[model samples]
Target: MLLPSLYFEEGFKVIGNMVNTAFGKFNLTGKTALITGAAGLLGQQHASALLEIGATVVLTDISAEALGAACTALSCESTASRILTRVMDVSRAESITTVAEEFSDRRIDILVNNAAIDPKVNGDAGIQETSRLENFPLVQWELQLAVGLTGAFLCSQVFGSAMASDGRGGVILNIASDLSVFSPDQRLYRKEGLPADLQPVKPVTYSVIKAGLVGLTRYLATYWAEQGVRANALSPGGVFNGQGDEFVTRLTSLIPLGRMAKADEYQSVVQFLCTDASAYLNGQNIVMDGGRSVW
Candidate 1:
């Protein structure tokens, strides 16, 4: 029995529409996402991903010069109008509160707590003392916690409350690390011939800050579950950032995938967590470590 051509075309068109509708769950049209540390390498990538998905990205960093440069760079990929830049010092409550008030009129649907000090992976002699516990300065550890952990807490409290109060609800994506769940393999930071005591190791503060973010994720997830706000953490693996061949090879060997992550690799996961695609995901630390942690 031959169906009418018009009927067949209409049925196929309906199916196509359904698929597009489903795919649209990942779209962030009309939503605004505020990403801290937006001038940094990973922060820029996160902003790009969100902007590509039609989200209005408010890129905030402590350095005005870097933030301006990043916003300019990102403008090449997107319209200047869609990209908003702010000099936000996440370490201070006053800074967070000021930015929060400025954006209070806007409904910020997503917050990516991506600010943190990059651990000095390269064992330079000038900075060698900071990485080891015995010589790790108290001021450095306290400062790391202030920025990485305390910053997240303050942003969640202020921006998150705005989301709840507005009745729109939202998502908070904490940028954690694979170290959040597991201790850093100190061997990766070791130099070949150095004595064990004198060799550089991953700092104690890095793991503590990351682990705290994971704990914060779980707490916020449940704390605001009834208010329609969801919190989740993303624990990404080491990215290929022009490290020495020895470092890259040593790190990749430990991973089942046998390679460091490309810069753009984690963008899709950011899109997922920030959009409706991850509507039910909450309180979970999604580890995208290229199978490193498993091994």
Candidate 2:
């Protein structure tokens, strides 16, 4: 090791090439990204991040009006040339297939499975009794799974297949939650003076659906490894979205960072996974929870 002064001087040019290539990994100049649940809060952020990096974004949601509004809003931040809006229900295989067919000539370089039903809990004294597990509606459970879990599966199958068949590998970013790796502390949602059985509690379905996405990520990562497809999951912590002050205080206390996540905090990681920066990353569940899951 001590005899490398000449080697170091001679290798400077080679090292420069590596440095340039490393930074260049994050450039997404010619890729196309398809985001599910693109009408929602997080979906818009995903679209913005990808578009900022020069990727063409396809925003897909079940509602035409909401999707249009999201696309319209994004137009202000990014040019209309960078975005396309489509109404596709992930719950229906046919709908996903149809959307894929429409994009048959194009390869989806990135897919963000970001749709999920995150039901809210009333922080008031008289909490809604329906939030309790004993009274949780079976219909709601089915609906949550269909859209969150099944939807991701179908999207992966359809668009993921397109990526595979095109001989151009793609990135599948599954949006999971911190709860995917841990159980919800019911105490966080509990309200004072409410009857024991009536206090609002986090539903079982939310955790189940999120955890299922991790499994899907692993499956897809391995299943399409040979075809240049990389699948990964992002388990994010609670985001500060104007939640009740009481709920925010309780949730923050649980996090070691003493705060919730900012909405745009995850966009960089989104860029990493969708580009060559994470080319070697696959079958990994990256947790970005402000150290909440650890605590």
Candidate 3:
């Protein structure tokens, strides 16, 4: 009833090959990665990692010096050949539009939206009460959201349009944080008597802004699916090394992994989501919190 022995063996080999190819590695040889907040700790790691894996990386930051530094570091030896640098203020739509025009006819294969600010709420508290987000200070909440949220949206709208119209779909990875959830012990301000939302254990603006990204990503994912674009968020755990000692200690204790995450640990997930490997995953917030959410 079955096939001959040789045929069975050949069938087995074919199945194995198919499986391997399906789960095998992917390279980004002809792609370009556009990274905002591209000079910060995580940003550099993402840029360097992508470049190492063959993607040409376009790095942008609020500081001209920061962008220069990133380019210099990447271009210094072998890696330098793969980076392009820009100074951008994500808070300004005009700044984004300018860059968009400069890149007029190009397509950005991947976009990492990871810009942010650690603004104080009060004397040290991070959130200033807005009458209804209506009477909010012209500078604080609006400014923070503009950089963290609007900037991401602008990039998606501008760069995404170009990427799709090229008749090629692309990846958009939004860098969110565990603070997008109830960040009890992961505050970011130095002030006391802060609103429950803006405490040092979990900064108000950081949480609110990231939470908004969930919606932005979902909307874009749905909006662009037919166009071959994918959108998703990565909610990384509290990272160690960059933060102050006090904050780091508190965050470490809260982790089920019994330690804070190092920046390098996030590279694989980002690489997967940013490449063809995650081609079908969209509108999802993949948390990398070491099972903290589980506990």
Candidate 4:
């Protein structure tokens, strides 16, 4: 059926406005984003996403060598000038403070708390034995929490405070995991013929750190709402990072998508959370886990 000319004109205006607003919100030209653990796989991907939208990205990691390599890998003629690297230990307040001071002259419009000590559960018999909850080391527990949970808190406190004090408003994106909302299926890590005591399991620290991030996200979302700083978390599922075939098969069977996520799959959502595209979104955990949590 043909529409009236007047209706057509009004519809066209509404459609045009929506298109313009959508594109405008995603644009990050002149904004600056700082990412902790910037040398890691997901960290580099987050930096790439923000940089693609014209944001200046500050990549921070504890290892200068690793950060250097990441910078070299991400550098291209078009975005070379937009990429900056800093050696920072998230577990240390002074380290985070130093970086904040160095960038004091510029507005940090976005903060991506992507740092974490994710203990890989390779099926090495020795590793499996040590990873058991009963055998888990206290030193390892402290280190993981220090880097993952406390580090996010400290970064939010320093840079988040700066964003609030500036009164210009900012965004905080906490990198969580699908395990945040659910317990790990330890069966995925089971080794054939391994006795119960020798079986490898997902470390306890991973869950606690991620769950803590979600809680922190909620707290900060309300704590700084009036200050114009928004906080949110992204909980991603397992990524296909060269895990053994047996483990991959078992894990993928649990996901409806029948596959693990690619390293770059979460980039777009990272962009959305860090940009005005998600302006009204706050204090929520977005799980992108191939529908695994539902199962």
Give candidate 1's TM-score. 0.93
Deviating ranges (above 4 Å) for candidate 4: 4-13
- Candidate 1: deviation at residue 49, Å? 0.5
- Clashes counted in candidate 4 amount to 0
Which ten residues in a row are the worst by lDDT in model 3?
125-134
**Against the true structure, candidate 1 has what lDDT?**
0.91
Cα lDDT tens digits for candidate 1, 178-268: 9998998888888876666678888999999999999999999998888889999999999998898988888999999999999889999
Please list the C-alpha lDDT of all candidates, in the order they appear.
0.91, 0.90, 0.78, 0.93
Model 4 lDDT per residue over 1-295, tens place? 9889999899999999999989888889999999999999999999989988899999999999999889998896237889999999999999999999999898899999999998988657664487889999999999999999999999999999999996898999999999999999999888888888898899999999999999999999999999889999999999999988988899999999999999999999998999888989999999999999998
* TM-score preference between candidates 3 and 4, better one: 4
Rank order (by lDDT, best first): 4, 1, 2, 3
lDDT of 3 by residue, 38-145 (tens): 988899888877876789888999899888887777776446667888888888888888887877665688999988775533334334434223334566777788
List TM-score per model, in order: 0.93, 0.92, 0.82, 0.95
Write candidate 2's Cα lDDT for 43-122 as tens digits: 99889999988999999998999998998999999889889988999999999889888988877889999988888877
| Candidate 3, residue 57: lDDT | 88
Report model 2's TM-score to 2 decimal places.
0.92
